[model samples]
Target: MTLVLDKLGLARNGEVHLDGVSASFERGSLTTVLGRTLAGKTTLLRAIAGLQPIDSGRMERQGCEFGLLPPWRRDVAMVYQQFINYPHLSVFDNVAFPLRQRGVPDAEARSRTETALGMVGLSDFRARAPTALSGGQQQRVALARALVRRADILLLDEPLVNLDYKLREQLREEFRGLLTSQSDGIVIYNTTEPAEAMMLGDRIVVMHHGRILQAGSPKEVFERPANVAVAGIVNDPPMTILHGRLEDGRVTFGNDVGFPAPKHMDELSRGSYRFGIRATEILPSETGGVIGRVEFSEVSGSETFVHVVTPLGEAVMQLEGVHHVLTGSQMRLSFRPERLFAFNADGEGELVRAPTTGEY
Candidate 1:
């Protein structure tokens, strides 16, 4: 079912918010909503689920039944950041709560509860209280509850944020696999972390300041961010953007740094443009296109992030393999023209294929 959130707006007290916001999720695909805190991500989810009334705008669920309407009545289940299990209740009872509330027969509820717990590998802890469990286990119980309901549309709000990194990683893998198994439905998850969004989402909806900046596959958003804010958010080290100009059929970065202008950019009448290059595109070398001093280096075993203080500005590089370089070291880097990105000063971005730049 296509879930359309059209022109949604909301207000609370005297504060006005969400001006004409709209987006949608395709049936059966994992569409992860990405944004910073207070970007209206949660509000958007609540609006779609009909948990919060809107001031104006329509939420259209094509062909959905009304008796199947209300939050409990709809084929939807929400998993929150915190474990919402009844601490006094056993895991089994917690998982079975939804079924019991729905008035499912005792025999059927027992069977489904066990199945859901088993799916999350918590069948062994059925009788254990949530307070006795680890944070990860508690979250699993909440997930089990959602599964027992056999929801067609799973709405997850920061579901893994409360767990530690190790537990978060483990749960993320399991969650991805579990959600993947149910391809007949949809998983709409919200995440503030770019790395999590990259790993979990089949399609990413990037939001900033309560509006969607861009929406596409992981590669699409990463390689072709709609603007500078998005470019900085989606990548591991983020894309390196520099103020520059496309003049006389060439793109120049400050004084000595320049590249042949790709025909796509050349065709544009205006000469002013912004330059963007991913860290991988900037290789360290003595004879490369640009040279800079390494102001800072963050080496994380398998990879490194080098912040180069250059004549133009500081450019961050994401490099793989052991990093032997130290801060304050002079480094030279060059990027192929094709790997560079061109954008208008207003923050509109476009990817230029090597030897040719293409407009978005």
Candidate 2:
């Protein structure tokens, strides 16, 4: 089944919330919507679920059903960021609540509840009250409730935001796998973490200012962002954006900063353009590149991130291991022309050239 929206807009209390927002979701694939706070990610989900009224738009399930139905009758389940569980009820009871509301028999409801808890690895804690469980366990109980209902569509709004890092990582993986187990269902999630979306989503939908900036596979979006905002969001530590101009087949950022432009950009007029280079693409060089000073170095166990101040601008470089690169050390950084992404100041331009037939 598919969820369709046409020119959806939502206004609340005299405030224009969403403007001409349109998106469609297909069955059995995880679609992660990435948007910053206040960008209407949750609002869009709410509108689609019928939790909020649409100011002016049309939404429909593939069968043209759900024309006038509340959320409970629409077969759509949602999990919020906070764990909203009944403290006095056992995990089993909490999971069975939805089934009972639908008039399922007692034995069948119990069986479905057990199965749902098993999928989330919470079967052993089925008899415990919500208050006795840990934060992660309570969240699992909430998820089990949604699964027990066998929802036709699942909408998750930052569902793992309250858990710790290890639990969050594990649960996100499990949630993705569980969503795929249903052959006729769709799962739509909203998240701000690019890594999480890259890991869990089959397709990533980048949203900004209530509009979709780009939508593609993780590799496609990462390798070739559609705009500056998308390029900034897809990478960890983000892509370093520098202002420059193309002249004589070379990109000049400042007085001493110059690098050969990739051959793919040969067709563009020799004028101004912006460049985006991920931290992983900047290699530490002794010379033959732009000279810079290490303003600071952040060393994690497996890798070190160095922020360098250059005549052109501040550039962050990711290097493996801690090689005793001290702060204020004189260094040079080189750019990988193939790894660089270019965009125009107007925020609409080709991020990277498409690969040739023999390249891949």
Candidate 3:
């Protein structure tokens, strides 16, 4: 029910890829290893799959050691960014290949292959050659093949990257179910996309520079990032980091604008503080304290992000629906004090909530 990585470390090309990384992958839940490029997301997955050497670390699953085992000896399957399937093989053949190699009976392999294909919505394409399928369909076939193995652990490394926007959306809605279908197995996925991490990660392991930044539920890490690095990568438009002075629980910005300090930050000494707020938390207001000039606006489907230049710094405010605001126009951006996240110089921090009303 658990795959434990104890003091895991990996080095390559004279550089460290995973430095003392550690986390437990629990069965029945999707654990997402999230980070940007060169963050070791794939390296970590490969190490777990026994494809990459663990320079210094021990990996164990179900109370058994797997550090010295070969990849084929591990009960794991991986789907990659590239849809890797035999060009000459039919979808059904590809999905059945793993079972065939394992010497599974014909009837059992057929049943399991059909089941896996159906899980990926590829049952209809079973007879089609992999070369005839679209990229998304090919990826689905890869997923089906992996699922057919019924491995104890499933690894997906940016499996949706090659798909178009619409296809990505279509499969994202189905990925969660397919990945977690095996209640007794573990699904460990890796992605550089934070929004996707939040969408599918039941337990998100925030990683960067081959290190484990943080691990918690999606809401836990999103609501409270361990540092600026994790906070910077976890949001869609990214959190707006701002520098200001804190005096008597009040932070004053350079634009001569100030607001009550977060209640959670009451214990802090009056001094310089770095914090952040999500784009969606800030808004345009009539009496907003943080003022700025409209830089530009971007319309992303149902949401509109208004970029503004303020005395505090450049900030982005996310709003719903279309915006008629002209660029270069002045606008008042409101800061929701309670939504503020306080962090140290290193950017590790948590949300600061206001005191509950009528508590006294």
Q: How much is 109 displaced in model 1, in angstroms?
A: 1.8
Candidate with better lDDT, 1 vs 3: 3
Task: Summarize candidate 3's per-residue lDDT along 289-354 as a digit string, tens digits.
Answer: 776889998998888998898877889889999877799999988787767776654334444432
Model 3 ranges off by over 4 Å: 286-288, 291-296, 324-330, 346-360
lDDT of 2 by residue, 1-360 (tens): 788877788777777778888778888788999878777889888887889887787887866845357876777888888878988889899999989988999999888888888988888898899999889889888988877777888888888888878888787777677867743588888998898889889899888777788888888787778978887777777778888888998878877778787777787678877788889889988777788899998887678898999887899899987766789988989987766667885546546443232332
Candidate 1 segments exceeding 4 Å error? 11-17, 63-70, 73-75, 180-183, 262-270, 347-360
Give residue 206's lDDT in candidate 2 (0 to 100): 89
Candidate 1 has its poorest 10 consecutive residues by lDDT at: 351-360
What is candidate 3's local distance difference test score?
0.83
Model 2 misplacement above 4 A = 12-16, 63-68, 293-301, 322-331, 347-360
Quick one: how many clashes does candidate 2 have?
A: 0
Which has the greatest lDDT? 3
lDDT string for model 1 (257-329, tens) is: 8877765455665466667777877787667478889998988768888899898888888789768778898
Q: TM-scores for all candidates?
A: 0.86, 0.90, 0.91
lDDT of 1 at 128: 93
Backbone clash pairs for candidate 2 read none
